[model samples]
Target: MTGAWKKFSAQAGITMSEPVVEQMFGGERDPQRVADERRWFAHEMRASTYWQPDAAVLRAATPRIVVGIGGDSAGQLCDRTSRALAQSLGTEPTTFPGGHTGFVEIPDVFATHLRTVICEG
Candidate 1:
């Protein structure tokens, strides 16, 4: 968890202080709850956990949509993911502020972009 926090802080360009770090790790008072959440996320990432959506139903009910790619994301992962999603949705990916966790790091800017996307669509 410490390593993950450090990586996240670096990726998000957040300056972490000792008190904030302590509060973050120390807030997980319930060990069982944390373990359960971790297990749930692990299970969710498994390929078998996903179901194929029906294309016909998807096309019939799909609304105007845009795929948002994080402008500050490192490497090509976010770009590839956004492109793939956009292709699947038949829409172009729109670049948004910050990285993969952009919404958390830059909530105001992200919210503005999100609103713009919805309004423009």
Candidate 2:
């Protein structure tokens, strides 16, 4: 049986890139398969999002903003933005770990490690 992904994408106006298609399905495939995988990829990445507070808000409120960076996947862009905000606002900077998915995958253990950083500072 055929699904309506192609029809829907065309109707709504969306273009799926090739690599995005491959990553979702786990390997190289024909065009129809690629298109289906693209649909899956869109669903997955959009489902989960990490929320960090606004840097501007942090800077305005805190006397000194201490940015706790949580590795690459931990929202380092936010860390960078926060650090930049801290620098602009004259605050302190800090870092921690679990890489990108560490916190979500291993919250208790990551928390224990993160505590060490906070305690030291």
Candidate 3:
């Protein structure tokens, strides 16, 4: 888990901190819980890697779709993907506060931004 955190921090161009990890996984960080989370993360990673979006369907739904990228996630994988998706849909990504885990890190601010995006959409 520590190694993963370090790798993710480096990739996201963020500093690694124990507090961030604790906040992310909850203070407990129980071995079993961590294992479960890791397994779920692995599954999600694999699923995302292979699941290709249908361009026709995406184009049809483009107007209704809103791509969002975190403010601090520039050059990160999620940021790149969001930008690519928005471009493919002929739109630009909406910038939200904080990094990839903004929703978790700053729920109030993130919620407000999300609401604005949805209302505007």
TM-score list, all predictions: 0.61, 0.38, 0.74
Clashing pairs in 3: none
- What are the RMSDs of all candidates, in order? 5.1, 10.3, 3.1
For residues 2-116, write the lDDT of model 3, one tens digit per residue: 6666665676566657777668655557798788769856777568756767756988964688888999888887898789888888888899998988999899999999999
For all candidates, the clash counts are 0, 1, 0
Which candidate leads in lDDT? Answer: 3
TM-score rank order: 3, 1, 2
Worst 10 residues of 3 by lDDT: 7-16
lDDT of 1 at 4: 56
lDDT of 2 by residue, 5-90 (tens): 43443433434465543454344458886666677556743453344456677667745445655564333445555566557656
Q: Indicate the TM-score of model 2.
A: 0.38
On TM-score, the leading prediction is 3
Runs in model 3 lying further than 4 Å from the true structure: 8-14, 17-28
**Full-model lDDT, candidate 3:** 0.79
User: How much is 57 displaced in model 3, in angstroms?
Assistant: 0.7
lDDT (Cα, 0-100) at 49 in candidate 2: 38
